[model samples]
Target: MYLTQGLHRSLQRHPDKPALRHVGDGDVRTHTFAELLRDTGQHAAALQARGVKAGDRVALLAPNHDRLVRALLACWWLGAVACPLNVRWSAPELAYAVSDSEASLLVVDEALAGLVRELPLPVIDFEQLAQEAQGLQALPDVRAGGDTLAAILYTGGTTGRSKGVMLSHANFWTASMTRGAELNNAPDSVSLLVAPLFHVAGLGRLVGQTLVGGTCVTMAHFKPAAVLEAIERHGISDVVVVPTMLQSLLDDPGFAPERVRSLNRIAFGAAPMPPDLLERALQAWPHAEFFQAYGLTETAGAVCINLPDNHRDPAALAQGRLNSVGRAGLGAEIQIVDESGRELPAGQVGQIIVRGPMVTRGYWRLPEASAEALRGGWLHTGDAGRMDAQGYLYIVDRLKDMIISGGENIYCAEVESVLRTHPLVSQAAVIGRPDPHWGEVVHAVLVLADGATAEQLPLPVLRDWCHERLAGYKCPRGLSHVPALPLSAAGKVLKTVLRQQLAA
Candidate 1:
C-alpha cells in the first residue's frame, strides 16, 4: 500500500481532528484532517493535470511547511516518487540531485524560486500551485502495490558524490511499524518535528507518528525558544531530536521543568550524546522518557535504541552503555565484520552491517555503487562499531571520511570539492577538529592557486565565499595557509598529516 493511505484513514476516523500546526511569518496556521485530505487530493489532481505520471520522479526544494507535506502526500497518492532535496545545499548541489534523479518536475516554495533559475527542468511554484489547487477535487487512483517505489533519499557517496537510496512503500511502512512497536506508541500521541524534513531521522518520525494516528506539531525551523514554546503551547507528547538540538534546549534559561514534564518521551539520534549532557537533561526534566537511537539513511533512520529504563539506570548510564545504540530490532540482523570481510567475534570493532525489511532497495541508477554497499546481502554501513556479549551495540568511530558537526554529516570530499572551486586554491584538504559544543568542526588547509597569498585571500573572505556555496555546517571553520599539502604514494591528499599539523 502507499504510505499516504494511513493519512487517508486518519482523515476518515477524525475528520475534524487537528492534523498539523505550523507557525510562520507571525501567524499560527493549522489544518484539520479533512482539510488536509481535501487539499492533498486537489494537489494530486493538479499534479496529474501537469503530466506527473505514476512512477515519475517529482523533486521538492523547500523548508518545513504545510504545503511541503501536502505536496509529498499528493505525489504518493499519484504514485510519483517524492524526492525532497536539502534546502541548505548550494545551487550546484541542488542541480546535481535534480539531474541525478532525472526529475521531470520540480517543486519550490515562493522564497526559493530564484535558486532554480539555471536548472533546465520545468518548475511548479508550490505557493502558486496551492492557489490553483483551491478549485480542484479528488484525483484518480494511480498508485500500484506495496512494493512500488515511494521516495528516493539521497545520502552519503564516495568523494562527496551523491547516491540516491530508493525506498519502497514496504520499506517505509515496515520502518514505521518496527519503530512504533518498539516505542509502544498510541494513536493519541503527539510528536514534535523540529528536524529538517529532508533528513531520514525527521522523515521517519513524521511517518511513524502518522502511522500511529498521532498529531505532529511542526516548527518552520528549530530554535530553542520555538521548541520549548511549541512543547508548552501544543502539549506535545513526543519529540525526536539530535543531541545538538537537545543540548540547545537545555542551555536555554527559559526552559522550564513543568513545560517538559508533559512530554511522553524525547528520542535523540544522528550523533552520539556526551554522558555529561545526558545527565544534565535528566536532572532538568526528570519526567520524560529518554531514548537514544542509532541508524543510517539506508535503514530508514533506525536500527537500535537505548530505552528509557537504560537511561535512568545509573550503572547503565555510567558504563556509558545506556548511551550505546541498543541491539537490532525484530526481523533485523546486525553483524560486525573486519576489513578482510570476516565476521568478528563479540567485543571486537568492525563496520556495522544491517539487513532487514527496512533496508532500502539500493542507490538509484548507480548499479556499481549499490553493489559495493549491498554486497553479501547486508547494507555495509561505514560506521565502526562492536557488539557486547549481552547484545548491545557500541558505535566506535566513523570508518568513512565523514564528520558529524551539529548532528549533520559533513563528508570530507564534499568540503574538498567546494574548496577546490575557490579562485585562490590550488589544492585543499578538509578535516574535523574537536569542538566542545559541536563535537567536531570542519577545518581546511589550502595551498594557494598560482598568485594568491594568505594576506590577499583572508580567512573571512574565503569563508564567506564557501558559505554561499556549501551548507553552513560543511563550511570550514578554521583556515590554514599551507606551503604544500601532504600526499601519499598514489598522489592522494593525506588527511592524517593535516590533522596532525592542526593538532600540533
Candidate 2:
C-alpha cells in the first residue's frame, strides 16, 4: 500500500484524464495525469540535484494551488518527507517549524519568497522549482513505501507550543482511502480546493482526489461569491469545507439550490458547527449529502465520519443522536474513558481516545509529550465526548474549556448556548478569565447585532439575560463586545489570541 501507488497506476490507466485545474494570476490552468507525472518526475530530479535525498524533509509554505500538489507528489516520488507549513503563520512561526523539522530545502510560492529567505534552509520558489525539476531524469527509487514518513504536520499548540505530528505513508493512504469509500467517491468527481493545502484536512483531500484519478479545482482563497461562481461554472461535484466556510456559503444571498444542483456531496469537519446553521444548510441544499467527520492533525485527518444514512434520518436525532459524529472509520478504534484510563459505559461523558493506523507515530522528538499524549496504546484526544448504546458519538466541550468557579464546575458552552439564543448576538466566544478570588471567572466576548453598542448594552443586562437561562455561577462576570474575533484562515476562533488579550 504505497502512498503514491494510485497516482502511479492512474498514469498508466488514464494518462490523459483531467488531473488538476487551478485558477491563479487572472488565468485558469489544467493538467492531465500524464502532465502531472512528467512534472513530478522533473521536480523530484531537481530536488535530488539540490541535495534532497531519501529521508530529508522538504518544507512547503504556500496556499492551495497546482504547484503545492505537484510538490507533494514530487516529495513522495523522491522518498523525501514533505513538511507543509501553514501559510497564514507569521515569519517567526514559520522559522520555528522549519528549524524544528530540520528541513534541508524550503519551497515557497513567489508570494512568500520574503518569508522563506529569513529561514536558514535552501529556499526554492515552488513554481520555478517544479518547472526546473521537470527537465531532470525520473529515478526508479523515488516511490515511497508505506512506512516512510510522508509529512510532519504541526498542530496548533493550545496547551503549550506546537508539536509536529509525524505521518507515515500508510497513515495518509488510509485516510484518503477511507474518505473516498465513505463518500462513495467516483472518478468523475470534481472536488473543490478552497482551504489552504497546509492543513491536513485540505491537503489530505488534495492527495485523495489525485489518487482516485478525480479532478481538483484549486481556489487560492475561499470567497463566498467565488466559491458559488466556481460551483456554477465548473459543475463542482464535491467540496470539503469547515463549519465556518459552510456557514458563509449558506448565508450568501445568491445561494440558489439550483446553482449548486450538481454538488452531490459536501464534507464538513475541522471545527464544530452551530446545529441551527447546519440544519439550515441541509434545508438549502437538500440534494447534497452532508457528512460531518471528526478528526485532528494527530489522526492524519478524519477518524470518524457521520454517514449519509445518519444525516438523512432526523428520527435518529430525536433518539438522542442529534447529528452525532458517527462510529469510527476503518482501521480505527474509539473509546470513552475516565482519568484512570478505565473504559466508561455507553452514554457516559469522558475523554475521547482513539487508536488507529492513521494516528501519528508520535509528536516529533518530544518523547515526554509524546508519552503523555499516547498513553495506554490510545491517542488521548483531549476532547470530551460520549457514545450512545448504538455507538453514535456526541461531542461535549473541551476539558480545559470546563470552568471551575467558587467550588462549582461550569461548562462555558452551556453559558454560550444561552447567550446565542438571544437574537441580538451575532457571535459569541466564551473563555475562562483569571480571577483573584475564584481562581477563574467566565468571560464572554460578543459581536452584537445591528444597532447595538458595548457601552449601551452593559454587562449587568447581559448578565441578567444569561441568568434567566443558566445558574448564577455560570453567568459571565465580564462581557466585552468586539467588532470581530480573531479567526484563523480556516474559520476557527483563535482562542489563544482571545485568552491573551483578556489576560492583558
Candidate 3:
C-alpha cells in the first residue's frame, strides 16, 4: 500500500479533524487533515518544480515539525524516497549519509541550515519551500506501492560506517498494520511524536497513527516540561518513549500524575529499560498500559512486542514475562538460530532472526552485505537472545559491540575509531557501562601515547574532543588510563576482561 493512502482516507473520513499539532518553542500550531493534505500537495509540487522525479532521493535534516511531516508526504506523493539525516550526528556524519543516499535535494530547518551550507546540493528551508510553492498546482499521486523504495534510513554498521537501510512502502505498511493497537491505538487517538522521525520506531509510529486516522503532536525538540505541556493541552492518548525519556519526565519537577492522566498507552523500547524505572513508571501511571517493542532498522519497526498484559502484574517480572521483549509480532516470525541457520530449541541462547513483510529489502548499494544479512530468508539481528517455551523473547546480549545510550545506538568500534584519532591516545577500547538513567553509557579504556601521561588528558577534556568528532551520546562519559588494552590472540580487545577488572 502507498504511504499517502491514509492521508486520503483521513481527508475523506474527517477533513476538519486536527491532523497535526506542532509544538515548537513558539506558539503551538495545529493543522486539519485537509490542511495537511493541501500543504503536502504544495510541497510535492515544489519538489516536482525542482525536477525531483520518481525514485529520486530527497534528504531531510530537521527535528520533528509539521512541515517536516508534510515534506515526507510530499516525497511519497511523487514516488520519491525520503532520507532523513540524524539530527544528533556531526556535520561530517550527516554529510556521509547524504552522499551515500545520493539525495537530490536537501531540506533543513533554520537551526541546522548553516551546517549544510557547504554541501553541493540545493538547500532550502521549510519557510522558503512554502513560499516557493505558493501558486504551484498540486501534483497528482504517483501511487507508488509494493517494493517501491520509500525511505533510506541510516544506521551504524559493524565496519564503523553508516549503512542506509532501504525500506519500501510495503515494508512500512506491513509493520504498521501488524503493530496495530500495540503501538497505535484507536482511530481518534492523539499521539505525541516526541521521538525523532529518523529512526524506524518513530517513523513506524507516525505511519501507524496515519493508518488509523489519528492525530499527531510533533515536537521540535524533546523537553520533559514540553512533553507534559503537550499531553495536558492536547489530551494525548498515546505516546512512545525510550527508558531514558521516561525517567526524565518522571523526575521533571513539573511532572504530576494528573498532568499525564490522559495517557492510556505508552510503548517503550529501543534500549534496555531498567526494572526499577519500569516499576516506578507502572506505579506512576496505574491506568496506562505499557509495552516494550524489540526491532531493528532492518525490520522497519516492531519484530517482537511485550504486551501490556505482561506488565499488569508485579509477579510477571519475577515470572519472566515483564523482562521479555515478547513474542513475535503479527506477520513476523522470530527464531533463535545457530551459526548454520538451524533453529535452536526453547531456552537456548542464539542469534535472533526475523522474517516478515516488515523486513527491509537491504542496504543501499551493498549487495554482498545484503545477501549476508538476509541469507536463509531470515534477517539476522546480530543480537543474542533466547525464547521461552511459552514464546517470550529475552535479549541476553548484543553480538555486535553496540552501546545504547539515551536511546541512541553508539557503535563501540566507531567510538574507538574516533578516540584513536586523538593525539594522546595510543590505543582505545570502548565498552558500554550500565547507567541508571541512560540505559548504557559509553566508557573507554585507553593507552596513552609515548610521551603522554594519564594527567595529560582528563575525562572532561576527552569528552569535549570526542564531541567535536562524534555525537555527544557516542562520546565517552568516563575513561580509564591503562598502559595497554587487554587483547585476545586475534588482536581484538577482550572487553569481558576489561569489565571484570573495572568491576573489581
**For candidate 1, what is the lDDT?**
0.80
Full ranking by lDDT: 3, 2, 1
lDDT of 3 at 422: 85
Runs of candidate 2 exceeding 4 Å displacement: 450-452, 455-457
**Model 2, 190-211: lDDT tens per residue?**
9999877778888788878877
Q: If both were scored by lDDT, which would come out higher, candidate 1 or candidate 3?
A: 3
Worst 10 residues of 3 by lDDT: 485-494
lDDT of each: 0.80, 0.83, 0.85
lDDT of 1 by residue, 332-431 (tens): 7889999877999999878899999889889999899889999989999988888988889988656765788889767675577568777777667788
Q: Which candidate comes out best when scored by lDDT?
A: 3
Q: Any runs in candidate 3 off by more than 4 Å, and if so which? A: 157-159, 181-184, 314-318, 402-504
TM-score of 3: 0.81
Residue 500 CA displacement from its true place in model 1, Å: 14
Clashing pairs in 3: none
